[model samples]
Target: MDGQYSHDSRKNILEWSLPVIDEKNKSGSLEFSIDGKPNDFFPVHVSFVSKRNFCDIQVAKVTYIEGGSPVRFSSETSFVVDKYEIL
Candidate 1:
């Protein structure tokens, strides 16, 4: 899954979730990209691994560039799973 949002600030929040049945291991990646000319700003990236049903949240900050203004861009990822019991 993927998504994107625009804000006039240098920081943004992201929320996501994942579920596992009887305890399972899974891995995924979340990526953020800024639409603008390359400057002295550092690129932002992250990775994670987890188990069971849980909610994941993170805050993404836009890189500050000299004489640059915040602009619209695409960036976000998430997932969900259903847990069930069997006897």
Candidate 2:
């Protein structure tokens, strides 16, 4: 499967989950904008080094961004979680 890495400055919630083995073996983090403000849940910023395919990525814990902004990867256009290895 093709992998995509990008850097995005979107303020949203990231949902990290296990990779899906089916359907081209594609996977990625679920990024969404915060609908409401002053919420209890805090958005987690993920960063890691990957060597295998995008589907093999290991989703790390939520890291609060210094600027409180979400940045995409640096591979393709979109981010693939199926091959990402959380470091």
Candidate 3:
């Protein structure tokens, strides 16, 4: 999945998350910062692989500097697919 954020100030923190794969494969979240002048945009990407017949849900949170304060936004999505079988 993908996400984008805009900030009005320099040096802002961004964070996002993906549903936990499991105890064995804990591949769930990410964070980073954008450093630049106002009107800066940042793009984020997330990807994962899972066993057949599995489902996953993901979410994203973006925190940025706006008007000298922190503003936050979030979104979530999910998908499911049947296992592939070859004979």
Best by lDDT: 2
Per-residue lDDT for 3 in model 2?
39
Per-residue lDDT over 1-87 for candidate 2, one digit per residue giving the tens place of the 0 to 100 score: 133333443843343444344576644444445456644454445554334554655544444579656555454333445543432
Model 2 error, position 24 (Å)? 1.6
C-alpha-based local distance difference test score of model 2: 0.46
Best by TM-score: 3
Ranking by lDDT: 2, 1, 3
Clashing pairs in 3: none
Candidate 1 residue lDDT tens string, 24-62: 434433355766565533343333344422554544455
Select the stronger candidate by lDDT from 2 and 3.
Answer: 2
User: For residues 1-87, what per-residue lDDT tens digits would candidate 3 score against the true structure?
Assistant: 323334433554343334445567544323444457544543433343444224444433444556455456565443443443222
Full candidate order by TM-score, most accurate first = 3, 1, 2
Better of 1 and 3 by lDDT: 1
lDDT for model 1 comes to 0.43
Give each model's whole-structure lDDT: 0.43, 0.46, 0.43
Task: List, in order, the clash count of every candidate structure.
Answer: 0, 24, 0
Which run of 10 residues does model 2 get worst, by summed lDDT?
A: 1-10
Better of 1 and 2 by lDDT: 2
